[model samples]
Target chain A: MSTLSEPPKQSFHMGMLLNDTRYRGYTFQFIALLALVALFGWMVSNAVANLAALGQDINFGFLSDQAGYDINQQIIPYESTDTHMRAAFVGVLNTLLVAVLGCILATIVGVVVGVLRLSNNWLIARLMSVYVEIFRNVPVLIWILIVFNVMANALPSPSTFRGDDATASMLLGAFAFTNSGVYLPLPLWLEGSIVVVGVFVVSLIAIWALRRYARHLLYSEGRVIPTLPIGLALFVVPTLLAFFIMGRPIALEYPEMGRFNFQNGIQVRGSFIALWLALSLYTGAFIAENVRGAIQAVSKGQTEAAASLGLRPGRIMSLVVLPQALRVMIPPNISQYLNLTKNSSLAAAVGYMDITGTLGGVTLNQTGRSFEAILLLMAFYLAISLAISGIMNLYNNSVKLKER
Target chain B: MKNSLLLGAIAVTGMVAGAATADTLQEVKDRGVLNCGISTGLVGFASQNANGDWQGFDVAICQAVAAAIFGDANAVEYNPVTNQVRFEILNSGEIDMLSRNTTWTFSRDVDLKLDFLGVNYYDGQGFLIPTELGVSSAKELDGAKVCIQKGTTTELNVADFFRVNNIEYEPVPISTASEAQQAYLAGTCQVYTTDASGLAATRASFEDPSAHVILPEIISKEPLGPLVRHGDDDWGDVVRWSLNALIAAEELGITSANVDDLAAAPTDNPEINRLLGTEGTLGEMLGLPADWGVNVIKANGNYGEIFEKFIGENTPIGLARGLNAQWTDGGLLYAPPFR
Candidate 1:
């Protein structure tokens, strides 16, 4: 190693912004930052001038005004006399509902397809490949259209299910499927429903405790006790006993067929069904690939080692393969969930009253406040995407590998 | 990095603000093309033909304005816009005039600061339903599933109508007119509601047009016209009179065939002579040639001829001239005398 005894005499020069080693990065960054500011300032000034010329402003006062329109699918109470902001809130709720539902469904479908594709059964594996290929290659928009069309056309209209001797009948005499929507028996919460739910939750905790006790017995005592049956008993007995003791607090209101449609039940619009199903199926194909790759990434040696230690194949998979593969799979899976959430904005195509369909679309048109509406819309999407990633990141950290 | 990104955005916005700003008329003259905004594919209003040319009732207005300005009907470029972006596209100077079938509401005209030239079509909100449903009148439409195009006046109108009548209805709001039509036909909604003219235009394209019947109740008035951005009086006058010239031509019985001949020689009637540019300097006041009236009429005949050619009873749209006829004929179409 050469010992540097003395430093060269340094002089500040104007060229240091580009050529000097020590101060160059800061100088260059400053210059770049200045250029960017100038560019951005120029564009904003231009937009303001343009808006002024057009005799408009970027005001957002329209949110408090009465929204003269009505929304078909609103989770919250809304009327035509409600403010535009309330209408938008309803839209936000609808968007969240569909996004959450789509994510859950997409994950389930993706994992199933992924595992089945790697199955030893040749026919099942080939079928899974075909399903993935067909869904992965087609555009999500076309899939939405196709699914929406099927829901609208293939289903029988309510008039066909009207009479007593009607050709069309409700599923299980409780659910009605029509071109308008899928109607199901509405669940009514009674006086003791809360107690029932509490008992069920307690039963879940009891099952977890029972499993721990089983592990303790295995460690402390030489005799092994079968835990599955005991855990099942712990899971069901308390919930069932509480439900009966509470006199079956939850009652279902079955749908009654009317002249035009089924009444006295909850209805899910066909648009919602189509959008939900299409988003799940389309995103599932991509996630299937992710899951398959993650599983394959786990080495054969680990499974073989578990087998040599007298572990069953199922035990080896649950204890060794899944735990490792899940760590590799989680990060990509979070992104797929985010993708499904964002793609739910396409609900406008099928007339689902999501946030985009209501606020970004109808309200923007009605109010003619495109600048403010669009800015708010972009902010909403960014917030939602960031929030989702933030949550997933927290979950990911918990499941991450801990190296000693 | 974040600061740089923010600065970059500001710089881009500032650049856009510094973009070319000039008199729209002079810009049009310099560019030698009239940037006309139109709908993408509304059947009889603005759609591309097999020959790949934009032709419809709305397209004729654009061509007439271009003819009056440049003395060439073909000196116009069509920009297809959706309902959500039409106003921004016009306000941004991307288009010179919007000849799309936009309604002239009080808010749109005064609040949005747009100058509506003249009403080209007088329409009202109406309901179209499949005849198999056995519903005759709109009053019987309680608990109905209605399909409507979002971002339109019809959405609010239907809601008001239903509420005032103490009825409950579910609205399935689609984004595009085509989607609404598909939803209606596929029995997703029992009733499809829109402007009477739009219903005609949509029904005319159906495979079985007779299967649907339009309900009798007319809910709201929708006077659709061509418009331009406010604060440009010169450009506004040019577009307004170009439309007026068509109406006046129809009123005075001066068609495309007779406009040139009548402009060549003085006419017996003073109004016809003045309209044909043989009696006054009307065209000069709006910054056009002496033969502006003649060019406009010759570009797309008279308003009557355009109406007959596009949405008239003779066409597939098969619409009768109800409120669009002349004032003397007990219709609402009245043009100020070109003195």
Candidate 2:
């Protein structure tokens, strides 16, 4: 004790770890981290011991084995003779396909419905409300089942289109809708098809350039250009001209009745349609609510200020409020997209060979590698979710309030 | 304090190790109920009746096992498992054994570490299609969508047969038999393939059974039976012999009606005497009551009786025993001696 003037020279003591304010936080944090690490270690060791006792070891060698199964929709050419790794890749592609399609459709439908929900028309607003409430409140699994069952039962079998007195017929003698799937005429890429495709791509770029140029002209010299009609003409005329110049090289291969069913065309399997439509409709409702809330969150002052600026109602919404509301809408929108992506696992109910259906399903069952399969499945989803959040967060940072 | 923390971890490890080595039989006895996995629905094999009580060829095995373990046939928690989850359920110990129509395979038995008790039903894969398809042979099914139940040997067999025959068929894999039936009936698929027995059962459940025909293509040998997890040889023996007792009971002419009387005293037949636990201490060797076989027989009768009651030629399923008959009757069922 040195007269208590310098706190006894602040001597280090074991008790100080808990009693002293300066070290307490670090001490507690170290203890918590130790407990967490120990817990994880215990869990992992317990699992390993139990698995060994059951005469199983964690092995992912099954991925190299033959899949020996068929997938309904394959973006890549996959035979039953392909390896399980290839099968999983096909599953990943299918999962991505539905997620991408669902996100696009849901965004479009959600924005429209969300806008309509705030409309002055009582009937339209109420109808939009009814749509959101009915769809969002119900579980997505039931929707998937409903869509799959309706498609399977309500649609006629291809056999019905066989006889002279056919009960069902193809649509416009081109698209065939049956219980199995919808078939559309596939475009045959001929020698000059590339030229036609190139011309279309060029016309699309031209339209985009024209819009930018019109914006520039409007800003630099207050000249109004009817870019919509010009852009439309640019979209169609050049492509049509190139097609005729290339002698209409793209021919259509119509699906005709083969020995068993309609063959030789693009058969959009019913499983894909059921899963895609169900996910889109279900996730669209939640997105609609998000959009409506986000749009409303934009201060009434902003809308009034735009109106006072002599801008039209549509112009005020598009130019002033929506861009600002988007800042509020993005985080929840990311969550909805993630939900749609993950909910696509319900594809198994309808036998759509998404990642869950293949890797977590047939492959897991066949290989009897539940632990390894589930571990991989979780890792894949984690990676995907992190990537989605990372990208969306970057976009969020870009669109949010910035320092001047 | 550190000692206490270390002790807690040790205790948890001990608990996990203890669970791994836990005797399935003793667990079932302590719980007073046997968890038995069966198919979601295969009419004559494992489907439920109108009264919500399970009555089928497969359900009888569950009941018999429960009877052997608890002496009450009703002491069974029936777990309806899909093809995708049957092996997993068995391995997870959620069920003592899977009585579902699972085919015994090399990878499943060796790699997956399952113990197939014995072949309960000898079957072969076949296709069932509508009678109006105007096609008779399975070989003629080209470019057709085939509705198949996924996660079974049947899944692989279909792919194999199609490849070998140089045919192109689209596989529409569904999960449960009920779903497959719905898809097949709704015209989503031109062909539905599974065990011939399963096909008969599915057809019989149909409102118009006459509208379907089983194609004459027996693609693969499907030796479906009850199975347990590997390891725990003692419990494995109990389940294995439980199945064998039913099979042997049929061969020894032990009907459920006469089982009790025959079990009361030693019979002239030594095999029957040993089986009924009147002569030997085999039941004690299996860690059970000496009269377990008698309980099993009284629960579901013999194998033939169960077959007749559920899926025999007399039933709506109308399946003849075929290769499932006793060895004396020139079929494949040959149970090991009770001794």
Candidate 3:
């Protein structure tokens, strides 16, 4: 048995700050705080003195100055006469575009490969295992370089696409992949295309409502309503009807064969293609392992219980195993997405003018503002990473189980 | 406690500030090596040879400076920096002088606070294209994809050229010259544009050098040279005169072969006497020994000799000394008189 009582009372003294046990933790913490402040102060002071000696000052006035450089690809209107800020904005958009595209592609490839790796088929499982080993074991940078080289050497020249006796022909007579880039047909929005798109959105919401109604019927009246076929009808019937009523308001603009390239079409540059494919394949390998681990982490007893309850194998996976496996999979998957986004900075190696290629690179070299440019680059990447993690965390919270 | 911490911090920072403001010349002397900035590798301009020794046009300049200071041509420590980090390395005092192939521009001089001593190589932007392209003039390069070295004036120059000509072209900005060369050869781009000297160097390294032709268009002036920090006039003067000594040696017919003989006895040319440090105390004024000019010429023969040895028509690079020849030979290279 233990009892709490004041056995002795001692008077406090000046030496107690160092000797007394009760005040010891606070004293050490106070000293540590002071040391941290001093270190920071010393570093800042040294930086200030060094800058002064170099006749340099931290200036942001150059952001508004004319960039006087042309960018090959831009999503918005940009000219050489635009300001540095405008050029940087274009770079930021390009970076985001590739990162988003890479993440989506990586996720799809990862989930497919992850699930297939557990297949009972020996041939298929071995093939997937080989792919994962080769991609995951090699450095991502080397993979990027290798992919870029292969694309550069393997693709036919644009000139080969020209003339009646052309050496290379476009696949499906629409997509042209050349040494420079890939060209594809773009969608031409006719007058009533907006109405057609609106109808499609309405149909999607109607399908969701139909599924909810089916679930309510099953719960309240013990009457099982077949939702899949009705939901499919809701998904297609309105959209098809709207398309005809609106005079089929979407048209395709095919890429026309030109002397050097396929003009009048959308061009996806080879650098972007290489960077996207390399990042997806490399990151997908790691993500595949995460997915496999998560799936296995779901206990086998869950599947057995579902089987005993007369659930089919597919339904058991969808309704019982998957939901639980996803919770385990998503947290690690968020980190993979973050990794892919950060690795997109390597787009510079292939000349894809991402944020690092333009602002942190050429702009810094041109303006001699390394300190400011690097600081801004760090800040932008930090913000992007934190934003990705924050959004993923929120989604994770919604899917997480309630605990006692 | 906070007051004592503040006092200690101030003391430490004061020592750092003192070290940063130390005279670069004295520091170099104390360190016993002149830190020189150069490119990672650019054939005939700044690159290491097969013998694992640095030998190039820009390397000669650094050697000349080192010889002028210590009477030893090998007294330099070369720091090979990438284009993205060269200026920062120079600005941070990590290198004593930047002898890299850096172009002198208005902004680099006035805004970046760098003092360019003199232009050692007069290069202008030009284009290189494969023979199959049949593009003789830059005007024919309309709608062509061009490979350009990034972080340099070539990108902006090419952009301005295309825009002003009212022609459309795509720029594939590459990080290094080797990458640009690879991409151009791999058919990723139709044209490669850089300084004319750079084009020559790159073409010489190509597997089929004869299959490529440089377009006859010098679009922009790129006066490449060595530079130092703006406020350091004493060091700047030493570097300027060392380069001037080479130019002067070429003009006076005093090559490395004849430098010692020319300095042994007073000649009819008093300017030669003053330059050879026999008739005046010019080296003393620069805080160097009496034979500084002799050492500089001995390090690298002379401007013409250096040019011929590295990138002249006889060399693999085969760059013609067109505008780089001396003023007396109807070229732009004119040095200030030594008197």
Candidate 4:
């Protein structure tokens, strides 16, 4: 009887009038949205007016025009006469190449250092700690400069390194290091090698599927298989078979020493190598800290419980710790990847012929289209960053812990 | 509230009036200084000395402009800009004029809306290779790794030269001249390509200058000059004619040593008298004093004097005035009549 009466008494007060306090919150939110929209609209209008005053039009039609420039160290086929759009495509591909390579190398280095820092050996742990602290504290720009300068100044001239029978010299034959750049052997592919590559890729996919199936079998039936040896066999068998079947199609093209320098081999300019190494090492140091923090966040009790169940130390780590820690590690790691991609624009400083170096620097100066060029550069960076974040979010969702 | 609104309206009107009356010349005069943009550490062009004083061929031009405007050459602020940022700095109105070694191109003049004053240096793209290459000409540099500075015409010229010659070459592009030099020295590239003057400057800084040889090939013409923004025709004329005065003074043999004497007494040539402010109102036409040209010549000795002091055969650059010689000497450098 008291509960029923209390309900009616509360309803009577609720029906008295409309609430002004709740409406005030909605009014404030509406004002904030309007202010933000107005600010953006005003900015757009100002930009249009300024461009008009300067007799410049904001259009992307120039993207289809000839680039009329050459880029060094291209992984894809590009010529000086290619369209500007195509040139930017090449830049995007190069940027992805560096970012992906840097991410892989950084992850390996970070994991090793992170694990070593917690090792039982004091010397090893302290060494890794020192490395992390030193690299993380220094600005990446200084490291890039130091690496580039030392590589340029301390390397040998090609003339000194060139010889047919050159051995036991400062560097290998047809190879030299200098403050300017580095010369290395470039691989020349023989004809009909695509078949072998296709076979190799297919074999890799088969091996991956097999491993997954084996893991599933182990989980359901409590029966374990030797996955490592089987996977190795699966990889080697197909690759070796394809090589023999295709008559061994790939060949190495060693740099030949000419009169003044090496010729006919790919050369990695010192700037590219130095910048790539600096970005990787600096970002790796921060990644090491993130990895260590993530691993430590996993509860000790989980590991102990696994140990009580008679599981091996490696198995305990693989089954209990890593899966949990990866959830924590991935978000920060994604940020590092984005940072590496964005920081690649610093290639402009060293003249690596990246997008920023070509379109933003030379193309802008040569064409005098600053507004268009800068806008394109900004869009490129933003798209790359957003793509990386989107992929990382998908991975995060896949690995997230589920609870009932 | 009404009173405060009235006060705000009055303040807004006052601010608009103030802006409407603001002229660039008056602003610069009131500031008592002129901002000049220059390149970073080019040996004969623009470089700072050990005592931090900026001095070079381009620095002399900046000084003359300041002298023409303020009557005091020291009333100038030097802003060092890199090749990548020079134009942007000028476009943003961060500097009054860009006296850097910028190439005058149709795109820059029309598309960028910049007014190029006049050519200061007539340069050409060339190749520098180690002497041991035994390559006598650029035609033999097939399959060579050529180090090129990015953001310059050198990159385009390299590709065109190789393409037209039907030769295949690998390009090793870099950003700064110093980087290109370092790469060429390091054996990262078989050849370094840039302006002939830049090649000479880089070679002069090397310990073994004799080890390298500049290839005898002029691939493309690079007429380097100073530039100012568009929309300010008055300012543009002042800068353009100031450069013209220096060149004309060189042609007339009117240098700093004899500028005063010439200014005091009339010359037999009518054009000389007008140039020296003794006859016509050439300076007055540009809204300057009658003796503005004389002041400019007095400030920096003449184009010839400035060139000899900085990059002549006696200097480390040791550049011969081959194509840069006066029109009378069969070179391309020619100034219009002062009148």
Candidate 5:
């Protein structure tokens, strides 16, 4: 045993040497890591040197200074006397407003066009194909410009539509398009409308509970109840009763012609309308292609199996195809939403007071703080994109198939 | 590879040697060309015609600078620049001088480190609205949406003016003058704001020029002038005194027609002699030939002649030489002593 151990000492030394050799293989990776750190450090130092040379120290103190600029459309209260940070918040809110509204409208348009493009009717399919092809191929900026030009040239001047004349009334009632913007009636709430709204919320909960009960009855008792009708009744009955009890606290406020322009009701500027419409149309075209690809990605075998199980065509699509298609659809759809949010920045070109227009344009010019303005603008966009991705990832996870 | 390396070394040495000996003024003289930056089609300032030749008040300045440098009026290259990119281009040395209607402000001079030669045009920010709005004065534009071109001093002036007046305004900011004009015409904004001279230029482009009214309020001081990069003091002096020579020529009754005659025979006025390079070493001070001012006057008419030709009362812009007149006429345009 002593002789055998004495012979193995050299082998033990060889094993340690082999281990050291393996460790040396990672030296290249270590060097790469050090190189990356050095590159970043060099860049940071260069930025500091450049900033110092310009006598422009990077600080956020300017954000609290008076913005001294006015925003055309702000969701929150803003004034020229407000701080730049508050102005940035207003710009953020305006960006979110356009992004949210654009997403919802784009989704609706996308779904409709996507399904119509696969329709049995040839003419409708061809028309939707044209829409998708045209919008998807052209740059979004051109679409924005074209739409703005059309709105500017085609809409009647405000001076021509400021009276109760027959032509003016007819045109205003039909389209309500004016140079000031497109005016439409909004529902105005009176006193005690909160009670009615509370009733409506309670009814919605009841309707959801009724739907659950109906599903349970269908499974347990094998009795088919018209859940849609019962749900509708549960929703409308209490809301109507509360409306009468609260004395009908809602009224439609139609736009009325006033001196120089329209008064009352909602007035959306032509720039916003043109920009919103162009962004929705352009993004919806891309989303429609994604929807189509996702739908086609679902195996035909699933639909056939559902049909073999005696399900109708519509049920096969709803129960079998859509569940699987949605899994493939959500990731790409999130990216489209992000695209729509970023493209809304192009509204600046058309004079729409989105974040890029107000903060990046006028605020930067007024303050001469390009660094702060552009940094805030990029951060806002990044945060919005991350939020959308987070929500969509959760939705994708819920609809994803569990694989062995 | 060794032979190629030796050849590359020789080429780089030759290039450096050439660069070391190159004189900027002599290079310009030899090349017989001067690169100048001007506005992108402002009507009475600098604009291109259908024939693609630049003409107007600002263009004449470029021509005069070229003529001062190279004894020929046609030795100029004009590059159009917008407000957003003009300063960066000048700083990067892409153009020799910026003759666009740029407002000479404190920040541009000190912070940006540019040398504003002198105020060629005294202007101010003014508001313009459709006459149908019945707004005769800027004070009445309360709760109005003002269309302003972004990335310029005019935008800040608009905000400050509105705030000081206790008026609420929706600023519909745009990137270009054309966009502001379209927005104002389409009623997206109730009023359009810019320099008073710019308002006149924009209004003249309309089908009916009388349909818009320029508000009486001149809210901000805009001393529009030419500028060059900061460190080139010799170049700065050259541009400054060249402009002053034009003003001094007009004051001395030295028209372009009589400049050759006056140069051949010395004038009675010492200021004219110094400006025309007949007296003093002003030309030698700037490292130019003695007839530099004469060449400038020959290239373009004097300041008054150029202003009268482009934006005078008879022109479509119809701007009066109210504050742009000489000191003898009680205006602010007084040059420093030529000596």
Candidate 6:
């Protein structure tokens, strides 16, 4: 028979909040929180006091003021008389455009170079290693400056295409190459073009569905299908059929030589080209290293087992190696995307009218609203980085390894 | 305890930030150096020499101000500011004065709370183009791409110029004059726009200076001057009269060579005697020594000497004194009376 003995019950008292072990930890935490809140309150008040003393109050009315400036490349409508808010929005679009373009180009280059760097061919592997070392070791700013200089200096001027005895001529009689920029024919969308675009979209989805089915058949029924050839057929046939069926609703407006520049065409400015390519090449090098590490992280036995099962080398890689490597590779790759978006602030150096160049630049200087403009810029970059992280995490979830 | 310490630091930092808003003159005196802001490099305006000493047209103004305050021309700390951060740097008290080619405008003076001392260079915007481009008039420059320095009035003037002419032109905003020069030479931009004097300075540095021509268009009046933040009128008067002394010395035929002779004692010319601190108590009004004008003139000679030494026609800049001459010579450079 066990005799139960009750320990001495301590009475609840006000002193127990600090002396008792259970409450002491919480008491310290509460004190810390109180101190933190007080600190934050003090900082805000201090800033308000300092600004007031300078005869300046925090105001964002300047956003409605005229920008009084012009942008080199604008994706939306803008004028010197436009409000700063609209100008900032145009800057936002340009920044997004470069970031999106840079991400796509970096992924393509990083994946190709990463796979090639692991090749048994010594020359190819060594060359990729050299490229990664050179591009990543130096700062991104230097690469941007170098690429901008090369684009401007190496390209011929428009005057070279002028006279009968011209030293240079337009390529393909439609594309004009000049240091000012490359002049490409503008695409004109007429009536019924929307139907053609819809058809093209439908065909792309169909191709994706067919590929999924092909994979299903291979796994479940031991069947093989030539998905590439059939997917090409599915992609091309309907798009062409819809285009002709829509009565040729698209046309090209070729650039015509004006007195000073090529008028009536879209100019892909050198500044954009320089910033996009430089950011891609620099960030692609780090992504290459990540891919290389991720590939090696998957044990060698997996590859050997696939080889013994009579799988072809290319099929073994596509089916077994890269899919597993992607999970390990994605987290670090997400950070690279963040780095690229932030580094694009350096777009001002190359004269690319990205958000930093316009809003954080001329608008800040002209309106003398450096504080408000910078706060908005910081908010934008922070929002973009979080959004990128969230999108990448969702992608990571899809390839996550399953465990019981 | 750690968080409390951090909060204490935050409090101290706030007080310090607010404390720097005024009494800039005392701060400079305690530091024993005059902080002067200038452009990164504009060869004839502000740049470092072979001896690693800062020397140029704008540099001269800095030296004069420093000499007026410290009685030593070399008691200066040069802060090179870009087009984007000049005003912020000045307002933050990192630089006591900005001697860069900053224009005096209504907004910059009253709205931005800056006190412009006086105009040192009277400039106007103009266009520089390749000679063989066959473009004579700026109105003919329709559809041309322009490379211009942002944060200056040049871009606004060019935009207004083309808008008034009913022509469409693109502006490639560049950071510095050197990069703009590279873009212009590479033909990436069909035109480069800035002050006419700056265009001349840039052309003189070109490989083939004759291959380019400056378009005759004075788009906007840019009265470039030195400036200080408001609430320091004592320091402002010190800087203002230093500039006046330079201009008056030029009008009174007192060069750097004769400054010592003129300041030895009272001269026959009463204005010269007063300006050189050899008569009356003019320097006392500005809280400087009786020999304040001597220090200023000895720092960089008179305004005409400085202009001729750096950017006059005799120099490679080849800028003729069209509107920068003294009023006696039918120009607009007239200083206020000293007495």
Candidate 4 per-residue lDDT, tens place, B1-339, comes to 647865785686565445433455656778889899987778888888899989888888888888887778778899988777787788777888899888888877887788899998999999998897788999998767788876677788888888788888878766677777777877767898888998898888889999999999999999988898877778888888888888999999999999999889898878779988999888778777788888888886888998898889999989999998999998888988876
Q: Number of the top candidate by lDDT?
A: 2
What i-RMS does every model get?
2.3, 1.2, 1.9, 4.0, 4.9, 1.6
| Residue-wise C-alpha lDDT for candidate 3, range B1-339, written one tens digit per residue | 768877887787687677556687777878888999988878998888788899899999999999999999999999988777777788778899999889999999987889999999999999998886677799977668899888888888988998899878888888888888888887778899999998999999898899999999999999999999777788999999999999988999999999999999888998888888988999999888888999999997999999999999999999988999999998889989887
Could you tell me which residue pairs clash in candidate 5?
none
Return the TM-scores of chain A for each candidate in numbered order.
Answer: 0.92, 0.95, 0.91, 0.85, 0.88, 0.94
TM-score to native of every candidate shown: 0.91, 0.95, 0.91, 0.90, 0.90, 0.94
lDDT of 1 by residue, A1-404 (tens): 24466676677888877777888899878987998898778667766777776667888999999999999998999998898899999999999999999988988999889978998899999999999999999999999999988878889888788766677998999999998789999999899999989988988888888878877886798556888898888788888898899999989999987545677889988889999999999999998988899889999999899999888977887778878888888899988888888899999888899888888888888898888888988899899999999999998899999778
Candidate 1 chain A: worst 10 consecutive residues by lDDT? Answer: A1-10
Residue-by-residue lDDT tens digits, candidate 4, A208-301: 9998999899889988898889889989898888878889897767766665555666767777788789889988998899888988999999
Give each prediction's root-mean-square deviation over alpha carbons.
4.1, 3.0, 3.6, 4.1, 4.4, 2.7
In model 5 chain B, the worst 10-residue window by lDDT is B15-24
DockQ of each: 0.51, 0.73, 0.52, 0.52, 0.44, 0.66
DockQ for model 5 equals 0.44
Candidate 6 per-residue C-alpha lDDT over B1-339 given as tens digits, one digit per residue, 9 for 90 to 100: 787888788788866775655576677778989999998988789878899888889999999989987899999999999887898888888899999999999989987778999999999999999999888899988888898998888888887888778888999889899889988888878899998888998999998999999997788999999999887888898889999999989999989999999889888999999998888998788777889899999998999999999888888888888799999999999999878
lDDT pick, better of 4 and 6: 6
Local accuracy of candidate 3 as per-residue lDDT tens digits, A1-404: 23347655678887999888889889999998997897888677677667767777877788998888888889888888898888889899999998999999999889888878887899988889999999999988888888888988999977677777889998898898888899899999999999989999999999888888887897899788888888889888998999899998998888886533567779999989889999999999988888888889999999899999888987887788878989999999999999999999998888898899878877887888887888889999999999999999999999998686
TM-score of chain B of each: 0.93, 0.97, 0.96, 0.91, 0.91, 0.96
- Chain B alone, candidate 1, TM-score of 0.93
lDDT of each prediction vs. the true structure?
0.87, 0.91, 0.88, 0.81, 0.81, 0.89
Q: In model 5 chain A, where is the ten-residue run with the lowest total lDDT?
A: A9-18
Q: What is the lDDT of residue A96 in candidate 3?
A: 95
Whole-model lDDT for model 6 versus the true structure? 0.89
